[model samples]
Target: MFPQSTQSPPTSLQVHPVPFLANTQDADELGAGSVEVPSWQIPDLVVECPKRPGARIHKGTSLILPEAGGDLLACIVRSLPVLLQIRPRWILGYSMAVDGVSLRTMYRQLEHSGPCVMIVEDSSNCIFGAFLSEGLRPVSQCYGTHECFVFRTPRLAGAWRTEVYGRSVAPTSPSQIEGASVPKPESEGASPPAGFSGQKAKYFEALRKAQAPSSSASVFCNHMGIVVGTDGPALFIDQDLLRGASWPSVGFGSPSLCTAGTDFVVRNIEARQNRFGIGAPNANERPVK
Candidate 1:
């Protein structure tokens, strides 16, 4: 999966860390523009559904999107009260142990920023979005079917971090957004990334190396993990999210997402589908301003 960033202004989700993915280092043309600032908060809703024993989260799930959303953040902000009200014993002390860039640097990148997107998975799997910033958006990207530690670190590379505890949201299909209604004709983005220039062969090579588990998950995290919210979200990425093709080398799990729980807290999360008032995820629809 080729990780992507929302170029235009964000929609329901606020792209925190305001600069998006800013590049601190300067290099030759090839390296100069490589670092993409993240802007949009890839939107996803929390539902109240029954939880099975193992890695399955999509069974008997209900659709939940907030209605009466005026702006992008409003849609996201709308859900906070609901989640807090339920308060189903949040997963605390979430630790991401995957090896990658230092937490110090990551903190600095996010400190004093708006909303930021954290791509936890490597290039092979679907990209996951985690908000690790100080800003507030009602809705947040939750994990579906993956075993990993995704904490809410709003100020990465900073002196301190505020963390949220919770059971991961299971992998959900994009079509499930509105819950049983005829899904939208398309997601927010109507077109692929502009200029859309890249090497398909090399991209495949990255994918091949990504799934191996032996390879660095950061590549996948940097490459395609951000857009893995759904099949369509994965499609927005560079690699094929569905093919499940093996990377040339073994892929480590989500690189950016540090998993820690050596001191694990096993929370028994009751499966509940959240009926958010919002409609479908405007995957293709974005704010122009």
Candidate 2:
């Protein structure tokens, strides 16, 4: 089983933090570049899937990517523009745990930027993910606010779901409950953060209240626990709203990527810069601009 992030991004799910697994052979070359940042790599792993897989279930199970998605994972990596500034560490499966040493290393590298992508497969066989742009932290601290994007592939829309939460249309108190949705902050007469407008403002406002120290029901108040009416630290992706003509055919858990040949199943993910290319990963080159 994989590990879950001890920390999480605001309103998004906890992620698995894959620390930079340094190869002794490449130790000397790691010193190059202006930042001296260690390139994040996905070490290989052996995975086991049930005779019949279930949706959103990761207990003792590893996921397999579909054959059509040969380039899908690559496409997903390339789709993120922020990868240019900060590196990415993928967390496979929500329930997986990461070691303290690795988490510390990731923190030193990610300090204030980058993303941790959460990958999981649902009962429907569709892949789902949460990209926490701000990265992870100790669950005790208030998870910082950054771009949170959710996506699912092989759907009608090609564009991934960027934002999902909205402020209640009416003025309500911060403490009031409105169905299964997270409560609103405008009820407390608070203004949205600077530079946030439209749905983005509304979304963050509600998130702020849910995580506020004053709120007894704060979702993030307790480290690594889920609250009712509050989606676990996950970034919500509305399948209906995210659909657009420009969306891609990307998804989580592909059978092809999960298997090497007929006999063996994939043990771990191999991070790639070029999804279409064959061979070792390009260690020196940053693929996206």
RMSD of each: 20.7, 18.1
Provide the global lDDT of candidate 2 against the true structure: 0.28
Q: Give the top-scoring candidate (lDDT).
A: 2
For candidate 1, lDDT tens digit of each residue in 145-166? 2211122222122322222222
lDDT of 2 by residue, 174-216 (tens): 3232222222345556543222234643643455444533222
* C-alpha root-mean-square deviation, candidate 2: 18.1
TM-scores for the candidates: 0.20, 0.33
lDDT of 2 at 204: 33
Give one clash count per candidate, in the order shown: 92, 29
- Alpha-carbon deviation at 137 in model 1, angstroms: 18
The per-model lDDT (C-alpha) reads 0.24, 0.28
